[model samples]
Target: MTDRNRRFLLKARPNGMPKTSDFALVEEALPDLQPGQFLIRNHYASLDPAIRGWLDDAPSYMPPVALGDPVRASTVGVVAESKAEGFKAGDWVMGLNAIEEYSMAQAGGFSQLIDIGNVSSPTHFLSVMGAVGLTAYFGVTEILKPEAGQTMLVSGAAGAVGSLVGQLGKQAGCRVIGIAGGPAKCARLTDDYGFDAAIDYRGKSAEALSDEIGAAAPKGIDLVFENVGGIGLDATLLHLNRFARVALCGLISEYNSEHYGARNLWQLIVHSATVRGFLISEFLDRFAEGAAAMAKLVGEGRLRFDEHIEEGIDNALPAFLRLFEGSNQGKMILKLI
Candidate 1:
């Protein structure tokens, strides 16, 4: 427990998109485990868009990642030492820890023991079987509630949560349409994930994108799973069916920048629609329920997802930037060991 740890700390609140200079990788001695605390040697960290929002000094669901502190992230690590009541050394666990070589936390809350018997890989705790998968599961089943013969539209459809949302929408027998950038991702939406149709939003204006959505879904969108907001959301708003339901998840496009325009917020009034903004944390008690259902589908090969893993604490900044750049191949993970 006397090992020196390398931690990625927030050096400054980012202005617009983050840069390497916004974070600092510093070495420090691991503190002795105090009473009611446990320490783990982190093996992997989930690189998610929500983590980016924490870098700003703004009020949110949680406090922002304070300057000169380890940047907060969901990490899977092994218990190297424990002074806490429920945890013991040599145990595998995952939780909202930080991006570092070693993380110290108290017992309970989000940090819980991992059943290695059910885990296929440590990274799966950060990907398909983890928060990413659970986010898609609860958002679709509980919030959006896609119905048979209905049309469901998912923005950021090529990425982790969005892709899974589209697939789950299909399981509900909804006609799923995905909005992604580029032809390759659009093709993958239909070819790989079984989306009924895909729209490429790269070169299109709001009107153009809305027209494409209308064509793909002439009946109008009954359920909208929104991830990337702004233009795509505005476009989708214009195409809502009467009394459509919209699940507002993470707005990745507005995280790094201060500029975000809806232009069509009034459409909800016009269409008698319902838009619910939710956090996955809201379903904390039902995690076991969602996990079991998603696990069954995954085990049967009915659910598919990919992880874009980048190794080393030294690569944390670049790996995170991949999410904003849309260059990441799958659910983003940082491998520290």
Candidate 2:
């Protein structure tokens, strides 16, 4: 491949919140693929809050997107050229691809092939059919162990994982309450997503938020699927029923903070509540199972998922900022030709 590759790079580590200066866009000629390698033309990229942790230099489940390296993201695209025996050109696949117009991968790096035959769009993989679905599925069933009639509250309910988690909770016969920023997102959660209740965190104080959540779950919350931590978790901790399960999915609030206060963790011990942190990578062995179950639910019209896509790789920084601003209603993706 002699084509020029357009890409985005992590120019600098962010101190608290990322700015446009943290990234730099560049163009380079693509290198020829070796035998057993394939060239991919990336079309869609997943923009996740977890990517913020990947920008730091600290050790994590995966290393930070290295300085000057194309930002790491899950992407869907078609194989333009292939030398591997199992893969042929024109196959549609999704996996860990850099945020760029084109990516070259050795055979081992590519995961399962995606069947886009009856799916709505390729971008679905970045949301319902991809890692987001797996994260929500496992987090709800395995981690939370939610029972029918139990009450479930999800922070960041408008996000990719949280939205699905809340819907699955409702499907399981639980009363679902969503916590999201702003009235618009709160309204979307209750009206559009079938949540039993939605609370606007921007308007309510932490104490008032706890009271509202408490009123929603009069019997006390059986499960809390947490995405944004810090204050939200602190407020919710005051209302946990005995033996409640809290799935720590992502700490978007604290992810970018230098230091965050947690003043209410003692309530966990008081209530015998259990909180477990989960990384989707740990459930990778069961990804196929999770994906199949989520797909079946979606195919059967038992689930509804959404994606907010921003066109062009050049807008990646601003697009990513949407996650923190609560500007996106679902899985956020970047489109690059």
Candidate 3:
């Protein structure tokens, strides 16, 4: 094992989209583990849109990552040493391990031992069986409540969460329409993920998108599982059916911008539609139930997921930036091992 720990620390708060220079990679000697603490050799770390929100010095679901601190991220690792009860060496675990080659933590925090017996790849814990799946499951099954024969639309439909959202909508018997950036992603949405139709929002105007949405869902959308929250959302709003529901999951389109507001919000009133924003953490108490259901779907071959992996801790910052640039094809993970 290496004697030093490699980590990326936040150097500056981002103004818009995060730049690689906003972070600095540093190496430090690993410390001795204390009683009740376990040492982890992190193998993989998740890159997510929520990490962008954590960089800003503003009120949010969690505290911001302080300058000079290791940037916060969820990671999967194997326990190399442990003094904690119920956790032993060689056990695979998941936690808020940040971006580092090593992490030391107590049992009471976000760390939890995970079973990888049934999974083909442990990385699925960061994709289909992890937070991405939980978000998609709760957002659609509990919040959006899409019905059979109804029409459901998902923005960022080719993403890790959005792809699952579209599939879940289909499983619920809804006619699913996806909105993604490129022709290939849009094609994958319909051909691969089972979306009934797809809209390529690459260079289309909002008016053009609205027309496309109208053509796709002529009966109007019954549920909008939103991820991108800019022009696509505005266009989607224009085509909402009466009493429609929208699960406002994430706003990746506006994550980097200062002026981030959606037009056509008035359409909510016109259509008597309901929009509710949620954090996956809010449903933590029932995470087991949701995770179990998602696992069952994966086990039954009813759910599909994808990951875009960047090898090594050295590539962590670049991998993270891909989330904003829309270059990542699926869930982005930094493979440190």
On TM-score, who's better, 1 or 2? 1
Q: Order the candidates by TM-score, highest first — what do you get? A: 1, 3, 2
Candidate 2 overall Cα lDDT vs. reference? 0.87
Deviating ranges (above 4 Å) for candidate 3: none
RMSD score of candidate 1 (Å): 1.0
Ten residues in a row with the worst lDDT in model 3? 254-263
- 55 in model 1: Cα distance from truth in Å? 1.1
Model 1: per-residue Cα lDDT at residue 159 = 98
Which residue pairs in candidate 2 have backbone atoms (N, alpha carbon, C) closer than 3 angstroms, thus clashing? none
lDDT of each: 0.91, 0.87, 0.91
- Model 2 C-alpha lDDT per residue in residues 148-196, reported as the tens digit of each score: 9899999999888888999999989999999998888888898778999
Model 2 residue 219 CA deviation (Å) reads: 1.6
Query: Candidate 1 lDDT, tens digit per residue, 264-329?
Result: 999999999999999999999998898889889989999889889999999999999999889888
Runs with alpha carbons beyond 4 Å of true place in candidate 1: none
Cα shift from native, residue 93, model 1 (Å) = 0.2
Tell me which residue pairs clash in candidate 3. none
